[model samples]
Target: MSPLFPALAARSARPALRFGDQALSHAELATAAGALAARIAGAPRVAVWATPTLGTAVGVVAALLAGVPVVPVNPKTGERELTHIVTDSSPALVLAERGAELPPILAELARLDTDITGSTEVAEATDTVDRALPAEPSPESPALIVYTSGTTGPPKGVVLPRRAVAATLDALEDAWRWTEDDVLVHALPLFHVHGLILGILGPLRRGGSVRHLGRFSTDGVARELSSGATMLFGVPTMYHRIAEALADDPELAKALTGARLLVSGSAALPVHDHERIGAATGRRVIERYGMTETLMNTSVRADGEPRAGTVGVPLAGVGLRLVDEAGAEITAYDGDTVGEIQVRGPNLFTEYLNRPDATEAAFDDGWFRTGDMAIRDPDGYVRIVGRKATDLIKSGGYKIGAGEIENVLLEHPGVREAAVTGEPDEDLGERIVAWVVPVRADAPPSAEELAAHVAAQLASHKRPRTVRYLQALPRNDMGKIMKRALHD
Candidate 1:
């Protein structure tokens, strides 16, 4: 396969990236990353303090150019997590923006301050730098070692191969109809796959530009989409904010209406938010399914229907199947029977770094076990309900999906945010519990009322047997509710 960034070396004067007030053209990025790549070349690996800044983008690109695997460290990570990452990855040096304050754990490592501003004297040397860079590494070589959120244990390093990145991006290009003329806009943090790999590298691989909002806000989203951004990428939290603000802000709705594509991922976007946004703006927010181990698997195609609850069909080259608890492949696409989603494709990561046992356990018959429970439509669209471990509730001998209940709960006017989980029950084996943040704390809806509301929408057995109201739901950086924290 060709190099991951062909357009970078093209030296086009077209704008390539924008973060807040800073902007870099394709030529500038190539020069800056190439220069940094020369300095960091031949390192075993490097850690990028992945802040949502121009420097982070350049640093990641530089590491890729030098054929060195890069590990993205979240800036908001606590001391213990940061220490474990540093100790596990054992990067030779840390790449961060100049003068940026780093934590003590990262500060202890050899640091290289990345310069986003390309040297003017290197204007003539852009081509020289490109030529001087190491030959494109083998497609199977490790490109990135991204750490998971470590929900179950200490974060495991997912080693992504160069081909996996290229394959996923190429597949998205086919699915989303993405191209060089498109300019993407988003405000996602750069530490994760959603923000760093897809939000940044996805555009670069297509030779398109991206404008980062630095932080998400209705004002920033409206400004960029209205000005010229063709596409927007965000998680459910950002989209929910847009849905809420559309009624009070006409400009926000109007800006969203003009966009070519609006994509949401990292978590399930509530059907309520989807309907609200579509009703106000005449544009539907597209949701895709992916994780740290798999860069991308399924996406609602740009040319296909933007189904409210479903994640559309698997992308080109991806093989998807549903399996039962006994590990039997569920062959029927009935749209009602739930099963664990298993996928096999080039988009899969090579392995878990230094965890051979864990890596081996993650796959079955060459398929990566996603641990996500979902139902597939006859038409092939996959509707994810929740994680197999947390979202699937067995009540009264009926298996229920928490995501469907959560979506229904969000439709209630009295509810602001909702998460559903199962707890041990003497009668039902596992009783459905609804954790809610109500619209009014003092005058919240009665548990009985909420339960009846759920029963009206879904089956009686799926209704929440117990309701726990809260001021707020605990969410991770990506806006996914930390379901395990609820029990704590």
Candidate 2:
């Protein structure tokens, strides 16, 4: 197989990475990553304390170069979550910045401090050490052991093979029309797939350069885009802020309007924000769908219409099918029927590490159960309704998706943020409930007004039976609305 980063060796002084004010040329980053790769070359596995710093990127690239399966641990993880991840993916060494103070949970593991300045202790002997390094890892060899958020139970480690990474990135190349000419920009955390794999490694895979904001700010976005950056990656929260700021900041609107692509993921980007940004800058924010177990399953094509509320067609190699509750596949794409999404492709993870039973149950006839419920339009665009466990609300014998209701509520002038859920009801079996953050706390929209707003947009049956006002909706690090937290 070809190298994941085919251009890393040939680019002489071309910029490859930028964090805040620091930048690295392709040759410089190769030397630094290669120098570190030689140190942990033959280790069983390595854990990276994934901060948004350049060191975290260096450590991850080094591990990939060494063909070592890297476990990227979230730096802000609580004790229990950290312990679970470290214990599950028992790595021989934990990689972190030179002066990083690790938590007590990582005390048992050996540590390796990385120098982003290209001046490691073994810098002098880098050439000699790299000359004798092993060949590229096998396509099927494990590359990453990413853990789930563990919302349901203990977070399971999803083992991703090198083939999965290579296939997904290559597929993205086709879908996004990505090339070395593009300069990617984002401020997503380095710990998750969105930031680490797609945000960082994506640019490297395409031989393009990346400029991480280190921290997300509208000013930083305008600075990079106004200079030379062509693409922006962000979650819903960031784009929402951008939508909010575009009304006041003409520079931000101009910078965004000039960008080649604006992508949003991790959670759904509200149709309201999508329209807001589009009206201000004429740039449609494209959304994609994927998870930790599957790197990427579907995305809106670069050449396709940037439609709101739908995450375009399936990726090149991915085979997608919607399954009913009875395990039957939904064949028709009439654009209204909801079914659970199941996918099969080379982009899928190999297994749930050390969890044989869970892995066995996750697959059915080579297809992995995605647990996400969505509907496909006649044009083949997939619109995710919500998760089956939480987002699918069965009320009055009708299965309602919280996403549709939430989107309608977002369009309401009085509602700033909205989340939909269901509760036990004797009459309807389950009643749809709306949790809303109002634009004006003192004169918030009444439950009847909000319910009417949703009924006018969607069906009356999908309207919320009750509404609860809050200062803000509960969200996770990824900006996903945590409905479970509402009951908790």
Candidate 3:
């Protein structure tokens, strides 16, 4: 297999990474990471304390260069979850920035601080180290062990292989028409697949540059895009914020209008936000779909129609199928039948670490079972409705997707944010419920008005049977609604 980053050895002086005020040229990054890679060359595995900093990126790249499996540990992880991840992965050492205080759970492990500025004087030593490094780990070798949110129980470690990473990014290079000329910008956290692998590594693989906003702000996004950044990668929450500010900030609108591409993922982008942004900037925000277990499954192609509600066709080399509850494949793509998304491809993770039973149950034949529920249009676009575990509601013999209802609710002028889930109901087997954060809390939209709004947009059976108000929906760092927290 070819080197993961074929261009790193070019030693160009072009800017490769920029985080806030700190920037590293391609030559500088190669020297720094290569030197560090030599130090930690033969470790069992390494844990990277993933912070939105230059050190985090340097550490991860260094690990990859060393052919060591790197586990990214969220800096905000609570003690219990951190303990679980450390125990499960059993890394030989932790890689972090100097002076970043670690939690007690990680006290036992040795720490290696990553330096983003390795002087060019060390170029010879770095080259010697790279030359002496073992043969590049095979494509099937483990690269990352990312932990899930543990919503169901303990967060399971998703073991992503190098082959999956290379395949997904190369496919994206095809789908996005991405090239080294593009300068990507984002403020997403570095712990997950979306931000860490796609947002960071994708650019590196193409020998492109990335400028990360230390924190997300409309002004920062506008500055980057207006100055030179060609692309933007964000979750739905960031787009929603962009939509909200576009009407008031002319600079923001101008920057967005000038951007070559805007991509959203990690959660569904409400159709209302999509239209709002499009109307202001005349740029359609493309959405992609993926998970911790699968790096990326689908994306709205750069050259194709930017359909607001759909995550475009299965990526190149990926096989996608919808399965019914009876385990039969649903071949009809009439745009209304919801089914569990099952995918088989190089994009899929090798296994859930240390969970053989789960690894076995996660696949049917060869397809990985994605708990996401989605419908397909005749044109091959896929619209995710919700998760089968929480969003698929059976009411009065009709199978309903909560995402459709939530999207409709978001369209209401009075609703600011929305989440839909199912509750046990004796008569309907399950009842649809809407959790809303209103635009005006003092005079919130009445439950009756919201319910009627949803009924008018979708079918009456899909309307929420109950509405609950909140100041804001419970969300994680990635801005995904914590539905399990709603139960509490």
Among all candidates shown, the one with the greatest lDDT: 1
Better of 1 and 3 by lDDT: 1
Tell me the lDDT of candidate 2: 0.90
Off by over 4 Å in 1: 118-133
Candidate 1, residues 175-276, lDDT tens digits: the string is: 999999999999999988999899999999999999999989999999999999999999999999999999999999999999999999999999999999
- Candidate 3, number of clashes: 0
- lDDT per residue as tens, model 3, 1-488: 98787667676677889998888877677778887787889998999999999999989988998899999999999988898999999999999887788898776799887645443324445546344333568999999999999989999999999999999999999999999989999999999998999989999988999999979999999999999999999999899999989889999999999999999999999999999999999999999999898889999999999999889999999999999999899999899999999999999999999999999999999989999999999988999999999888889999888888888999999999999998999998988889999999999999889888988888788888889999999999999999988978
lDDT of each: 0.92, 0.90, 0.90
Pairs of residues at least 3 apart in sequence or in different chains that clash in candidate 3? none
Candidate 2 positional error at 23, Å: 1.8
Angstrom error at residue 169, model 1? 0.6
Worst 10 residues of 1 by lDDT: 115-124
Write model 2 residue lDDT over 1-488, tens digit each, in one string: 67766656554477888897777777667777777887899898999999898889889988988999999998889998898888888899999988888998786789888757545634654555334334678899998999999989999999999899989988988999999899999999998889999999999888889999999999999999999999999999999999999999999999999999999999899999999999999889998999999999999999999999989999999999999999999998999899999999999999999999999999999999999999999989999999999999999989888898889999999999999999999999999999999999999999999989999999999999999999988898999988999988
Off by over 4 Å in 2: 125-134
For candidate 2, the TM-score is 0.98
Superior by TM-score: candidate 1 or candidate 3: 1
lDDT of model 3 at residue 107? Answer: 67
